[model samples]
Target: MPISHIEHYNLRAERSMLETLRDFYVTVVGLQVGYRPLSSYGYWLYAGERALLHLSEARPGDPREPHLRSTFDHVAFACTDLPACEAHLRNHGIDYRYAEVPATGQRQLFFSDPAGNGIELNFAATPDS
Candidate 1:
């Protein structure tokens, strides 16, 4: 059998960072909190029917790594209506950078969340535009 797509990605975070991550993803990234079902503290963020992002609380004894440079870069989403996205970000006072992909004409919006997690919004050009 062939794998279909990425099911989800888990982010291990300290307790304090959990709420920050939650707010950013919910308010800015446009995800909804869903059933996680884990005994530990954290969240499962859903985009539509599938939970795309998972958060797990790091215990006191868990090793904490300095994120001077994060090895895992950013999560990207394909979105519609670049104008609306820009206005939403502006309304929220979010700082973002925009660029068009080399040849695809896909517009990219890059920004960092409260906990410094990078996110990308890709807006593809529609046909007959």
Candidate 2:
């Protein structure tokens, strides 16, 4: 059997940081806090009906390796409204860099979360008049 697309991605942090992560993903990333069946300290963020991001609380004594966090370059999310996203990031006082794909002209905004996890937002190129 073939595997399908990514069902979801999870980020684990301490309880307090987990809450902050939830807030950031919800408020800044435009995800909604939805029903999470697991009765744990975490959140399930949904783009529509599907929960694409999961925030979990890291338990004490859980081994956290530096390489584990830094290995993956970043997690990217397809986005729209480049201007609005830029404004939102600026309003939140988050520093971000802008770039475009030379071949596709697709726009991208890169920034880090409170926990220093890289986040990328990709936008379709705007049409010329």
Candidate 3:
């Protein structure tokens, strides 16, 4: 069988930043915390069985480290519809930058979370195109 989809994402933020990040994922983004493994403080946030966000505590180190760069860029999530998604972001007081990719006909808006992790809200061009 073919692979299904992404099951979860593990994100790292400063050790002290967990609460704010949790609040953003819960209150603003509408994800519920799932079961926790005994050895970790991080919680698995559920959007669905195959869609989860895992928040992990960051280790002290140079912020300029190259390994961290890849994680800092951004993560994109598709929106059910553009208008609703835009309004939701606005209601949550999140600022975003909008762009349209002509080649794929996809529209995207980028924003950041409390800990400055980038996020993208995307929508497809048409219903049946």
Candidate 3 lDDT, 1-129, residue by residue in tens: 798887677876665577678888888676888776747566677776644788776666824221334535887787667888788889988888999998988999998877667878788888553
Worst 10 residues of 1 by lDDT: 63-72
User: Model 3 misses residue 75 by how many Å?
Assistant: 0.6
Give the runs in model 3 whose Cα sits over 4 Å from its true position. Answer: 1-7, 59-71
lDDT of 2 by residue, 39-126 (tens): 8888999999999999888788984332245576778999988989999999989899999998888999998877778889999887
Residue pairs in collision within model 2: none
Evaluation by TM-score, superior candidate among 1 and 3: 1
**Per-residue lDDT for 1-129 in model 1, tens only?**
899988898877787888778888899889999998888899999999889999888888895442547687788998999999999999999999999876777899999877667889999976743
Give the Cα lDDT of each candidate: 0.85, 0.85, 0.74
Q: Which residue pairs show collisions in model 3? A: none
Better of 2 and 3 by lDDT: 2
Where does candidate 3 have its weakest 10-residue lDDT segment? 62-71
